[model samples]
Target: MRGYVAMTAQEVAEFMASGLFDVSDVYAPTSQFIVDHQDLDDEEIEYTLSMVAAEDALEMKTATSGAACVLAFEVPAESISESHDMSISLSSPLKWESLECLFEVSSDGEELTWYATQEIDANLASWLK
Candidate 1:
């Protein structure tokens, strides 16, 4: 197979939770950080999440910076309809670099979007390293 695969929100959530991306170094510390500081408001929390997401994305991009990878985000919605909703794009040039794989975490925590190239989709595990 050699095309984009559109995964459902549940599929994305499951993939994200499957430890496929080796994000331990990227996101495992937030719990301790939050536990250490108990007075963060909504804005602070949101900002922290955004920063973490951005850093993770940058790390991925940096790894594939010069490779055959192209990472991008696809925006289905032009504007933010809710304050706590966000969408992120994670892409790479390998065999699946042509389309956008969206990672969306909605404010209600009820939705997610993820896609990938069929040929190298399973290779994300190795790539994240």
Candidate 2:
């Protein structure tokens, strides 16, 4: 399953160094998500969910005083379990091996600029310093 994870820029740097990404909550396309977005196709639904997650991440950034970004990853279907609410939880930490892409959420919360896997390290280097 493809999922989105919100993290601070510092967190992104740490994950890059450790080669592991662990978060209790990840936003993914769950059964409830699909049911909620019956009008859209799979790809569109994923994008919509990602934007919502990005907004939450932006709030986290403000509360924590750090830069916020969203990560796109691919994990096994069995790894994800739905929560009572709209979000889902991962059975275990997702590894860098599953990473697919990254999104830098704009400060104004109006845009999400994508970063490919190969570009992430350099982007973090610039953002952190």
Candidate 3:
């Protein structure tokens, strides 16, 4: 399944350096999310949800003090378990085997810029410099 994770820029760099990635929380397109966003097409819904998750990630980073980013990755379907709420949790930490995309959410209301997995390192380097 495809999911979005909230990650710090440091975390992203570490994952790239070490080839490992793990996080307890992931946001996905749950049934409730579909119901809440009935007006959008499937692609639109997914994009909308991803942006919402990205915004939330920024808030989390603010509380902890770091640069916030969102990672879009594909994981085994069985690895994820949906919670009673809208979010989902992973069974275990994931390796770098399935990352697909990345997003930079610098602040609220700004458009998010997406980066492909292959483009991440260069983008991160530029962002850091």
Candidate 4:
């Protein structure tokens, strides 16, 4: 389709400068994700998972730092009642440029609020009934 035109080299550079990425998939249930495209602190990793677990959201396994060790955590619940998009910081910086594929998932783990309006006529409905 016309929507899928390939980008030229200059176009790629421009896109990068325009903040065209959101790397949030590193904390998904179906994928083995690594945190922080850059180096980070151990506490940051813990904070990421704790946010997920506190929400009762699922992940593949434990979160770890530079080492290949498995990690576990308890979920966080404090921020939900308030509408905030959750995020985690990485323990150590990682320097990977491109990813092959990202895993995805959608669950009813948390409820979001929405509101809308509709029109009706009570008198007309009552007469029809």
Error in Å for residue 79 of model 2: 1.8
Top model by TM-score, which number?
A: 2
Number of backbone collisions per candidate: 2, 0, 0, 9
Q: Write the per-residue lDDT of candidate 2 for residues 1-129, one digit (tens) a residue.
A: 778888878888888889987787788777787887789898898888789878877877854445778888897777776553456788888898899998988888788999999998777865554
User: How far is each candidate from the true structure, as Cα RMSD in Å?
Assistant: 15.0, 2.1, 2.5, 21.1
lDDT of 2 at 48: 86
Write down the RMSD of candidate 2 (Cα, Å). 2.1
Residue 5 of model 3, lDDT score? 81
Model 4: runs farther than 4 Å from truth? Answer: 1-32, 35-39, 57-129
Worst 10 residues of 3 by lDDT: 58-67
lDDT of 4 by residue, 1-129 (tens): 000111222322333355243222223221123322224354554444434542432232123211111112111332112211233333322121221211111233242111111111222222122
lDDT of 4: 0.25
Candidate 1 C-alpha lDDT tens digits along 5-101 = 2233333334445623311112212344556546876556544544445444433343323112222222223211222223322232222122344
Where is model 2 more than 4 Å wrong at Cα?
A: 62-66, 83-85
Tell me the whole-model lDDT of each prediction, alpha carbons only.
Answer: 0.34, 0.81, 0.75, 0.25
